[model samples]
Every structure is written in structure tokens, then in C-alpha cells.
Target: MAVYEKVKRAIEQMVGDKSSEFKVCVEDTRGTLGGILIKIEDVKTQEISAFRINEGDEGEAEHMTMYSVDTMLQRRKAEGIARLEEIERVLGIKFEKWQREYILSRGLGYPIGGRRTGRTLAHQVKTLMKSKDDIIIYPNQRWTYLDEPERMRNSERYAQGYVKKLRELSEKLRNHGINVPRVIEVDDPQAEFLTKRMNLPARRGDGMR
Candidate 1:
């Protein structure tokens, strides 16, 4: 059997009836080198998960090296197990049972936000509102506070304005029953605002004003 076929069989056995609509296909990576991509969809909820198996080419004869059928099968099995664990962790339940109960009960609904992508102003405010105990605020914008000497020389006013904004925001949240203990000011490396504000003329060599 071909390498792709072997991989497909392994994934099928691992998922069982849970992946009735699964798909396994080969993707071209470059000239004479390619990999297999597998996509598994939850039968009840139709939620999809994907995994890949790259063509192994690491050795003295890198181009000549290829993954054996057994190696590909092992990789597919491991990836399938990982996908199940990820689903369980995100949804807070066993994958098999969750599929049978919650997914079937609610037609099609999947849990989101298992990882922290980035901090936004709205997200920070919401977190503060939900906190029961006093929470310290770390303003997401780094360039707002002049904690260092370089920052003080660059744009102290801009930093002050950022702190002022945080204070105002904290006050508003306090009115809504959110306890903000303190707001820690931190300096940002990429001072875009400071650069734009201080568009000073090039200084010539001398003690001239």
C-alpha cells in the first residue's frame, strides 16, 4: 500500500465512528516532496480538527530520506490522540461522552477561547469587572508609562496621558463594583506615539540652541 493509504487507515481506526466524515489527502510541499493532511469532523456537532504529517528529510542524504509507512502510521495515531485530549481540555469533559451528550443535546455548539491570544482594552476592563477581590491593573499599552530614563526624555507627557486614561477607566469600573487595587505603569519598547510627537529638527554639532 502507498504511504498515504497507510496513514489514512491508521487515523480511521483511531477515530472510529466518531469520524464518519473524515478526509485524508496528500499535499504537495515542493518538487518531489510532499506531506499528508488529515481532517476529522465530529459526527454529531460537525466540529472539525486537522493534523499534518510532513515528509521526513533529515540526515546526511536529506533528499533521499523518506518516512516509512510504519512511521507515518505512528505519527497519525499520536496526532489523533492529541486532538482528542485538546477537545476534552477545552470543553471540560471526556471527548467520547461529550460527543454523545452535550453535542447531541445542543445540536452544534463548540467551546472557544482555550488560549490567550492577546490583551485588548475591552478584555482587560471585563476581567476587572468580573474580579471579586482587589485586582492590580496592568495597562495593555506599554508605551503609556515612563518607568525608565530614556522614556522620560522621549515623551513624558504621552506617558502621563496613558496613566490618566487608565485611572479614568478604573474609576468607571469601580462604580460598577469592580475593585482595582492599583494600576502599574510600564514602559513600552516600541514607542510609536513618542516618535511621532517628538519630530524635532536634526541637531548640529555645537552648543547652539
Candidate 2:
């Protein structure tokens, strides 16, 4: 018999007369090494239990045992309750209801990429605030002046302005109970290079030549 069929029969036997209350589903994880997720849902109570059975050597009968399946279900139920409690404490709303409202209220934006850039700084700060850490400030690549002396001088001025804005933002977040790190300007190679570039005289005019 197929592994899925055997598991399904085992689950049915475990649920007994209350089998109608549960629904079983299998999802394939598409990749070179195939894996599958088995989910059992309590339709009446809207509770879900799941387990992953990866492609490998295993005694399937052992995992499909009534004791093993029941234990897994109980553990999943406990975890779900805990997660719901955490969500309630943080947002003062049940996760299921909040999820429904959130989905309806806003359009899901594009997926975030792994690489951090200046454009994603605001999002990064928001994520940091969600954590328990005192503060975190991740600075990405330094601004490139592209050999323009005047632009290099302007970049320094811009950096100062950026620091001021960061401080203000941090203060605002602190007022809202979000602790953020102090924004400090450090003397780095980029700053030193810009300073030297700013002092260099402009090249001779080609118009005169």
C-alpha cells in the first residue's frame, strides 16, 4: 500500500467514530529530494495538526501508530494555543480574526529580498522594533560619490543630516515604547576619502584647451 494511504487509514482508525470531524491532506514539497506534509484538521473546532514525512528510509508503520499520531496532534494543539495567546497579548486580538481583518484591509506587498539596501532601511527598523533587543542599526554600503569632488562634499553634509533624522526617529520610536540604538557618526575610510576629495582642486578646463 502507498504510504499516504496507510497514514490516512491509521488516522481514520485513531479518530474512530469522530473521524468525520477531521480532514486529512497531503502536500508535496517540490524539489530534487521530494518531501510531503500531512495535515489533519478538526473541521468543527477549526484546529489544524500537521507533520512532515520526508523522503527517506523509515518504518512508516511506527509513525502511523495510534499513540504516535495522537501525541503529535496533542503537541500541535498545545503549540497553537500558545501562539494564539502570544498574539492576543501583543495585539489584543485573536490571531484568526486579526488575520482575516488584516488580509481584507491591505494589499499584500511584494516579497522582501535577502539583500539589504538604503531603500529597505525603514522596513529593517520596523523588524528590529518587533524584537526584544535593546537596539540594532545595520548600515549597508556607503554612498558612492563616483569621483565627483563637489558631490563628495555634499555627501558629507547629507550624512550629517541623515544622522539628525535618525536621532529624531529613534526618539519618536522610544516614545512609543520601541527602544532603538543611538545613531552615531563614526570616522571611516569613506569619510576620509570624501574629505580628501573635497580639498582637491578641480581639473583644468577643457574649454580653454
Q: Please tell me which predicted candidate would have the highest lDDT against the true structure.
A: 2
Off by over 4 Å in 1: 31-52, 56-209
In the range 1-209, model 2's lDDT, one tens digit per residue, is 36566666776777665566567676676473367666767664466766666654225432744555586567645654554354344444443443323322212221433434222333223322323333322222122211222344457565445445555655655565544444333446465455458994322211111
Per-residue C-alpha lDDT of model 1 across residues 100-209, encoded as one tens digit per residue? 23222212222332333222232333233233333322334323222232434456466567456655666654554434434444345444355447983222111111
Measured on C-alpha atoms, candidate 2 has an lDDT of 0.45
Q: Could you list the CA RMSD of all candidates, in the order they appear?
A: 19.1, 18.1
Output the TM-score of candidate 2. 0.29
| Candidate 1 residue-wise lDDT at 145 | 28
Model 1 poorest 10 in a row by lDDT: 200-209
Clashing pairs in 2: none
**Residue 3 shift from truth in candidate 2, angstroms:** 2.7
